[model samples]
Target: MQANSLDDLAAGLARNRIAGLVADLRLDGLHSKAEAAAVQTAALDAYADDFAGYVLVGTSELSRRGLGLSSPIFAPLADRALFGDGWRIHLPQGMIGAQCELAFTLGRAYPERGESIDRHSAADAILACQPAIGLLGRRVRPGTESELAAIADFALHVATVCGPLVEPADKDSLDRAVMTARIDGKTVVTAKAGTILGHPLEALVWLAQKLARHNRQLNAGDVVTIGSCAPILQVLPGQHLTVEFEMIGTASCWFD
Candidate 1:
């Protein structure tokens, strides 16, 4: 029963039909980390087994859903899972937490074909990096350290958007740059890009290597969010949100 349930979860992810279902499940209750991991592994296996065209998207689907998994999942996977810098778990009813960070995309096929990515090469082949925001549903509590569980569950990652890429910056110097967000021209949250794992670039590099263990790699054009440097703030419907970076530029979105 356990294995079959795991396979079913994986198959759902492979089909990309699990998003709404996951959203539904998370809203209703939470699952154990082992169960969530089984779901993620199944999804990855199904993704590799069936949909080869969207390997990167299929692989990250777990990360996308995992964001919403309960805290039980995070406790076990924290040590084993490679965490992307930024991720958000949405709470029930529309309270949102926005996680902003830098992400990576691989220009070369990493960890090779037919095999999952390994930690070392996964960390090495970061071709391009971009600034991004991860929208978290504030109503949900997916637990702590469950990056793998969250990835397996889709990270509860609702949407991910990226700005233009800049050359990698040194860790110590990156923090001084200012980052600000305004909702309807009103400031919501502001901080330095270094809020994530200290230096956002290192987080990206770290994520690449971490994802390798599950046979995943950062692909060219794959959008990765390193971590949030700023605190997750409240957002609402019919509101327009904008963010600007001293060097990286700006992006905005409206909530319905």
Candidate 2:
């Protein structure tokens, strides 16, 4: 698609996103990952001043297969969508789901693009790890759009709620940590931290490398939420959700 047409598509997607309306099938015009990414960038550029960080989605094999995607995709995290623990999120129209995750806050800026960043380097840059819940919603109806269309729709990100930060111990200890999610105090799902691409830090490394490819780098004080550790649970209004990480802390929210 031409750049002007891509921009128009992005604008429509952004409008649908803000209005909580389903997008038309014209989103299928996105032909390649590059075009999808361009649309994503253009759509988010309108809110660049509110940009906080990025969310890496489809990091796990299960989620990737479920989404019919061959690799992971990322979306820009808006500052307005970030909340602290125990926040009450006003329920919006449309289907929504929550995923338990581990979030890393950066202590310092990452090296400029072209520099290599391994797990060790990635680990050293973290300020703390916290339990988090990522709220997801789709702007396009299921089975009605291609994966590229989903990418252009902001990777289904709705909001993120983070709990108290905890300084992490050794990487091995983190790998063994368990994550559990509860809805209305009933256990819904559980998973190990290693389930996130073998280690949560690997998610950081992956983000760093991926960002570098686009000449972008993580800034100090940015919070990056890795992929979900436990299975995503569909949530409803008037319901409460809590996620606890064995070594990290716990985070909760209410939909109302």
Q: Which candidate's TM-score is highest?
A: 2
Error of 1 at 253 (Å): 0.9
Write candidate 1's Cα lDDT for 161-220 as tens digits: 556666544433655668888878988777876654445545544555555666666456
Candidate 2 wrongly placed segments (more than 4 Å): 112-115
Q: Which candidate has the highest lDDT of all?
A: 2
Report the C-alpha lDDT of model 2 over 72-147, residue by residue, as the tens digit.
7788798888899999997655555787888889998885444569888888888888899888777765664467
Error of 2 at 48 (Å): 5.1
Q: What would the TM-scores of all predictions be?
A: 0.61, 0.93
Q: List the global CA lDDT of all models.
A: 0.48, 0.81
